[model samples]
Target chain A: MGQATEDRGTVHTVGLGKRYGSFWALRNCEIVIPRGGVCALVGPNGAGKTTLLKLLTGLNRPTEGSATVLGQTPKQESDYLAEIGYLAQEVPMYKQMTAAQHLELGAHMNKQWDGQLAVKRLTGLGVPLDKPVGKLSGGQRAQVGLAMALAKKPKLLLLDEPVAALDPLARVEFLTSLAEAAADAAGELTVIMSSHLLSDLERVCDFVVILAAGKTQLSDEIDHVLKTHRILIGPRTAETANPAYTVIKASHAASQTDLLVRLNDVQFRSAPWHVREPDIEEIVLAYMGQTKTEGGVQ
Target chain B: MNWAMWQQHKKQWMIFGGLIAAFAVFAVPTGMHFWHVYQQALAGCAAAADCDQLADQLFRHGHDANIFDITKFAVLFMPALLGIFFGLALVGREYNDGTNLLAWTQGVSRRRWLSVKIGWTVAITALGAGIIAALSTWWWRAGNALYLSKFQPLDFAVQGILPVALTIFAVVAAIALGAWLKRTLLALGILVVILLVVQISVPTYLRPHYAAPRVYTEQLVVQGNKNRDHRPDQAPVPAHTGAIWVNYSAVVDSDGTALNWVNPPEECSYTIEEASTRIHNEERSGGTPDVYIDREGGPAVHFRCLKEKGYHWEVRYQSADRYWKFQIIESVLYLALSVPFVAATYWLVLRRDA
Candidate 1:
């Protein structure tokens, strides 16, 4: 009986979609993020990154397909919502309320709110507890927003571009808080942070999901992506594809054909072209770019 | 949730507290002075030979009316202020600030959040509005006792349960607009317009017709046919008539049915009798008979003439005694009208994406 609820601490979706009027903000999105890993949801602007996060948080309902967060169908039910903590892109807080008041609000609103944790996080950041949050700096407000989400002690934390508006130092500080919270929770917490900034996501996220247009390009372990994808410079006379590999991107020079490929097999194959392991950023960019060349992103 | 809601209300609460203090400071003293004046007027009139003249003097004094006018206007717009703060800003400002994202994503569902908010807002609004209405009504008692003008629009709109109901309606309607429009300023603009129309139209068009009006049919007095004392075409209605006259002059038949003529008050019936000619002949084959030329032009119909013919001028008016009855009627009307706004607010908040 306990295993049923325990098994749900993960996110899995099949062909999930959200449409606003005639426009689909997110569609045909299939991603699987198991519990405990920090997943980076990277996309271009208006790429449905926020849409996917909102769907998982139950802030918005899906227009098509299904999404299960922590093994429960996302909805407005308190139990379901309690299991997931959501911070919107703007990191909205009652501007008139102080950080301490926000904690009080969180405690009143959530069943398992940890006021001490929130207080500690905010106080450590030198965010004044008594001043109204609107009077605080952008970084402080974002920290308070994070503390609010953290205090809930949710199994799944869905943050939508939480640090998008902060300064560079503030961005690092915000990410550091997230990393610390994830570490403190050990493997009991799963965080999905969406942003178009690759460097901000690269340090904290062990898992990655590349979304572009209304569709998801790739979802996998970061380490796995780094290991599987290759930059192969083959002869100019050669074709781009082979039966054994999937070419994610390809370009040609007069002397050589440049290709970014994901390995289909693990075995060491005698290939004609030289291979170089591509970094996560390069792989993400390649996948994101692969969609654009096919056209019709907007 | 309570703390957050309190944050929303903090500004309004402070302002309300200040208003209450001002009213207490001003109303109590004024009320006492008016009471003193009223008692003195009554005591002086007891021994006076002409109490009607003294009463008229008291009515014309309007001792408390000017000061009460401020309170009256304050009570009037207090509900409109509720529309701006509670109704229009309730959901609309949250959306405006992008805070609904934070709010709706809480462990509580949107509908529950809205339900709690609306409950708190409406309860407190009605309570505050009740206080204002009651205070204004109590303060105006000395003057109302003198004039009994509670049925008048200005008096009715600010007194009794009517203000409370109007306030609830304002907030609820504003809430619906906020939810539907999803913009604070726009919702406020529309809400103000709606409330303006409601306040003006409800009194001018709807309040007087809350119940069927009664007819005050005067017994006609007959003067001697030779004497015609000029009574103005429309008699001036007394201030203390204890009714709001919708129609001051209407001719009613013996059955008390109002005539639907172009001008009902001008309707009259007459007949030209045969002429009895008075002619004198000095010398003729036969003596001449007396002829009455009054037949050529008979006496014009006069008030006394019409009065004797079972025609009386009726005053159509809503009775002042039915003041509370109409208050209840209109209060129920406003409250019932607010149900749709409440429903729409809930539905919109629940269904719309945060």
Candidate 2:
């Protein structure tokens, strides 16, 4: 096995594009994610979030541009794949193979497997290793996939909706175990996960990269995104529209109006509309809605 | 990783092994009876002045002479089923099971994956064919010894070897077909069609003529006078009598002219005198000679003469040039078919939209 390095893991894609015949799934998307922190890639369905992850993982190639994982081209440097753990969106598993058999196969094939860690995780999760994967419930299967990914002790982890099939409790437990595993791995674990469940992302991700219509709407530290973005509610008749506030989006329901305003707007004042701190969910939904208005949803 | 792949295919391998075992067990006894009958026929022929007479006697006595033929027929037919099964399952099972995706994602190059598959299939098929050939050969050894004196080694050689070789060839062709088709049922159908076409066509249309026996007889002419007899031309026209019976024949020329004869006449004219004499003899002696007269005696005729005069006729049997060319064309067609299948698989696997 190669010695682990201390360099921060980074994913960089420049003008990355994907198209299926006449329809473009993603186009000219440029984004850079810094290492050592969880980045939540949030988007509506068909926003090309899955495509970007696949391109980054080397499962698919871009049509126009290129992507780099840890400074190596994903397609060219498949050896680097060993250092990255990926849980595909569908999580295809050998249904006939038992959970233990799947793990054994993974251990045999993966260069970074830590058997003890996998056993401990499976045991803690109460997953019966001997049970056939097809016989297991959807949540159980997802747990098995997670255990396999975490046991690899990867430097980078890319998961596509890992908990989409799990129930609420299992989803929480899976994410909690993931966070603990990341911490136990000494923060060398850099994870990039896409999810429509913004709450789950908000719970586990430290950074956020919002994608809409196959383009990056915004990407920044979670804290910074939440702090800089605010939801304002006030009277529609209030003629005091401040110049400091950039009204990212404004929608009226009944008499009162709700405005998702960027705090960076120079005209924004501490007076008038009641300003409330926006959570990650609001931030993601705002960008999604704005992108939708700019370009109709795919 | 290799072991894991093998384990994944273990059940399939076991099934193949069981099939081979069953074939061996069923075939051994029948094959042994075939060898014993052939051995007795050869021994009887050696002890008699006329082998054909001995063959007639053996046949009349109902001495299980058909056992050898039956065994040979079974040997020819049984392996074709094995070939079809092996070919149909080689790659189709993996694609059907979706385990191929797992292997592909596990860092195994697509080329390597395909190579392993083809390698394993060819190796196992070859092994099975070899075992069948060996066991059949062993069981037929006694019959072969018995027929040694009655039949030429060449006859025995074709009887024993050609069917097995053909069966193996069909199996290989089936593998290529299955790989190209990507479906077991379709591949098997194509294989059966090919086998049926070959079996039905080869016997009637392409049977080699020269495989039959040759008989040579000459007329002794006692000239009317010693002086006239002394002259070569006056030596009663030196009547020659012979019959060249051939099942198939061919003539090849450097100028790209080729002629094939299937089931040619028993006797042919060698010269003008022979032709006239053959007609005369048919009228007078009631025996007609089938002779091919080459007036030009060009390279084409000369080549035909050379081949017909050879010891082993089938070795020079060139009647099926068109069929051989068709086989080559089919090979190219199979190669062409593989391209789209491979391209489609790669395209689906690496498509940008997943």
Candidate 3:
């Protein structure tokens, strides 16, 4: 019932910058995300994640450089917006309106709405159609917002912590729906979700973009990032000797020292030293720390 | 566009329409009753023989039902409220509900969004104003016809329509203020302050001044013999007191004599052969009549009578002289007040962020 998979334009930027007076919300940030894949943007509070999303959605204009959504200028093209579904951080829905009303309003305005897909998604998420959004719980409200965004059947989905406020059960259900929705198109739908929940992003994100202090610390495939980085635990004396390894970061707790090392060369050998794959959380924190030490967040 | 303007705002429209309808139903009958009461008071004064007593009664009657009391306060207040509500809710609700952002992001430009909002508000305001105007006009027509026979329906132009237009302008201006401010309560505060200042200031300091004639009547007796057929020397009649004599005419020959010479542009003077002073109250019953004197201090052919009634006056002149100038001046003033509102609304909408 839908068109076959085709290549959509990548999310590309060149020296994109956003400034609020003297404070740089995001500056000198350049990154590229290939088409039709899931990318998670992980950042802490006040790290300009929301500002970056606003700029990418054209809700806010960039102070310098340029960013494109599907090869169209985000600020100028309204047609591109129709193809891009955005769920802002707060999910700005009419409070007095019901979930069904929000969906209906969105469907009426967007020509690309797929009624069957929307119905299936709503039912799957157990979102009450008859309940007014204001009367629903926070988790239900977030689900309603997600349903409205998905009803448009957009080519690119930009979600800002879509499940952050959800309960454990609701959060899992919400992410499952996202995975199913993306799977239905056979990886054709590209999703860029920003969240602080690394474990939740680990379940669905194929790519990870870690940002610290308004700049990109790391942006790569999840598998490549985990494979290229390792957590090495060795003696404090050996760590202090600075063995032959690209040390991303090293910290001492009691007598054991934890080293986050980039395994660019695996020739380093030390007695009683163990190497294990770095978890996504460790990799993100290491990059965050590195950015922090370099004067400020990028 | 249709969905955003109509469906989204349907409930608000229904509430506004019901309120306006209720106001109209209430105002029309009350306005009619006041008009009737105005007539009764005037008739009661006219029945008295003592001129001073009659004048005193007329003054009290005017104090009770002057233009400001009968028309301005009674008829214009409801219309102004309707206008304010129309303005406060027009764009204030959209910004509050966050639906405006949804509409803006959905390909509706900010200009188009504001246009639709202002268009709908103006349409509703015009309808509400038209209803109030029509109802008030009908009530005033019946009341004026019954009581103040001299009152013309065209007087509604001043007492009714002008205030309605002013109130409507206030409403549109308030709505624009609401959109620019983006908060209903703040907009309402600003609107109230501006309206209070305008209402107090415009009527007192800036209201236009209109020129009206003054009329004075006097009785004069002649001492000359009636049978002699002689023309006694006519004394110069002084000009009417406190009035400028623009024209002079005489009703000549109580006995069917055509005084063709007294008909044209020439001015005349008649003598006070005998005089009687009748005082009804404390003031002089018949004040000293002004004599129109010529250069030689001789009586002229014609004399003008002037009577002052506050801003308006009655004279030997036609009614058109008083009515036309007042109407034109008020209309121009009303038109001038409306321009700032229109210009401000346009500028605010053009520069407002989506």
Candidate 4:
């Protein structure tokens, strides 16, 4: 309760874990997502991405450790839920209800619901607010579901795979509206969108958290990750040890060696090797792919 | 939130409304006709002094009793319909469609959400069941007076506040199971079984013991006394008309020991009456004489012989005067039974992960 206002608006988790029956869905998970930015959570399927989102929203209780979302324990604080908005996978709205009725539900159940904002966002994209959600197109339903999450005027909005099922055109529209909403919020709202796909998030997200096999492999600003990690192609040799940097992945050919490394210094210039800037997708795939071969299977 | 619940359950509300409308269609007309016949019968028979005959004429001899029978079934079915439509679908459908993540994550906590849902649905069920029970209670008045069965099991469930209480119990139980199972179809199946078991077992096991039955004692005539018309078993105990007979076969002795442990004194012995025997005459067996066999009286001499040993009959019964008291007690019991279910649903929704 005595924490500063800015710290309270951030999502800070420490050693958070969840187990189902005998299997742990997520363990030793730690990430702190700063406020006022769109954070992309990328992982392979079943990488505890959804689990982490649920934990933050207090939809799930962690089996071990704790999380403070918007300065409150999700399961403990009565007002904690009001600060966060969550949309589940597949965009689960009441299919039997019209989008307008869903908005009305939001109005009735939420104290700070912005019905006009949601209506404007949806109607701008030609989403039929009066039709039953079940009868809407897939992209339209996704927009309505997003409107429901956004209309609550939450400080932190958690969306699980919001654009995974949309067509290219619809995906563009969904992202366009989301970016517009984020811009409109003026840095008061923080959005975390989880997807296994990296390209869509790469374009829209400034912060990135990469999870693999129920553990966080990387969490940082996308620009920082891109700047600090690099691929170096050098002549092959048996000397693998290096104090200049840490290698994440290495492969050797007959006469050439390639190394993906996190540099000890982002400005370190390499004269003996040709260095290339890594794409965000390449960095995320490296993290996801590295864990797969090194016992990610458990 | 109240309006949200209605919007969510509008389809079920419509279906339940249709069910109640159907009940009204059947009950209103039949009830008026029944009341007319009953009023005319009372007015006609009051001067004619044929009340005994009229009781049989109005109930035991016509299709009029079927109206009461149908209404009884309707009363019994209303609660189950509420359980299925409102309770089973409340949370189970949300879980089925994955909408709980949407509903529970809104600006309200799961506890508040569930309480509003349970409270509103239970209130509606009680109100609807209350109206049906009241209507049926009014309708059964003619049958109650004519047939004198308001104290019986079939009539008791349909007559009083028990319907409202039982309906609350049904919906709460269904909600608990629905939350626990998280599947509407599965919850519906188990809820039907649970409601049936509780409804049947509670009455059979619990209702009879609510009030200690009156220990009605009387003595059958002793054998070898001045001839008694009819057999001793045919002797009717002195009880008010329409008093429910719980048990009529408990026999005891002067010292108040049950007759179950006593063997016959080298002769026939029974609880309500001594067993009779048939005596086939050795000589008159050839002629057709009143069903071809000579019938001898029951061991009336033996019951007199038993009376000589100081034995009597005890009947346990609930008099009809306690009907309203029983209604109150049972209603409280059912409402008590529903509290735990409401608690369980509360705990599951608030504590368990979605």
Q: Can you give the lDDT of residue A70 in candidate 2?
A: 74
Please give each candidate's TM-score.
0.87, 0.67, 0.70, 0.88
lDDT of each: 0.78, 0.61, 0.62, 0.79
On a 0 to 100 scale, what is the lDDT of residue A157 in model 4? Answer: 88
- The regions of model 1 sitting more than 4 angstroms off are A1-9, A234-237, A252-256, A266-272, A290-298, B53-65, B219-231, B235-249, B252-311
Off by over 4 Å in 2: A1-9, A76-78, A235-247, A270-272, A290-298, B41-118, B133-354
Candidate 1 docks with a DockQ of: 0.62
Note the DockQ of each predicted structure.
Answer: 0.62, 0.18, 0.22, 0.65
Candidate 3, residues A1-298, lDDT tens digits: the string is 1122122236777778888879999977777776778899887777777778778877678889888777677752447667777887766677777777776776656667775667677777677888778888877777777677777777778888787777788788778878887888676688999986466678998898878788887778888888788788887767334446677788887878888877766676745677888778777878767423342322
Report the lDDT tens digits of candidate 1 across residue range A34-82: 7798999998888999899888888788999998777678888788878
User: For model 2, how does the per-residue alpha-carbon lDDT over A88-152 read when each residue is reduced to its tens digit?
Assistant: 77566778778788777777666667767787788888888887788888778777877877776
Task: Return whichever of 3 and 4 wins on DockQ.
Answer: 4
lDDT of 1 by residue, B208-318 (tens): 677777766665443322222312234335345663535345656788775443333443322223211112231133653321112124422334445656876677678
Interface RMSD of 4: 1.7
Model 3 residue B223 CA deviation (Å) reads 23
Provide the lDDT at A121 for model 3: 71
Candidate 3: where are CA atoms >4 Å away? Answer: A1-9, A123-126, A239-248, A265-273, A290-298, B28-99, B141-168, B209-354
Worst 10 residues of 3 chain B by lDDT: B305-314
Q: Using DockQ, rank the candidates from best to worst.
A: 4, 1, 3, 2
Ranking by TM-score: 4, 1, 3, 2
**lDDT tens digits by residue: candidate 4, A1-298:** 4367357448878899999889888998988898899999998889999999988888888999888777777763348777888889999888879999999999988888899988988888888888899999999998898898889888888989988888889989888888888899999899999998678777889999988899998889998998889889888963545677788878788998878888887666575788888787777777787533443323
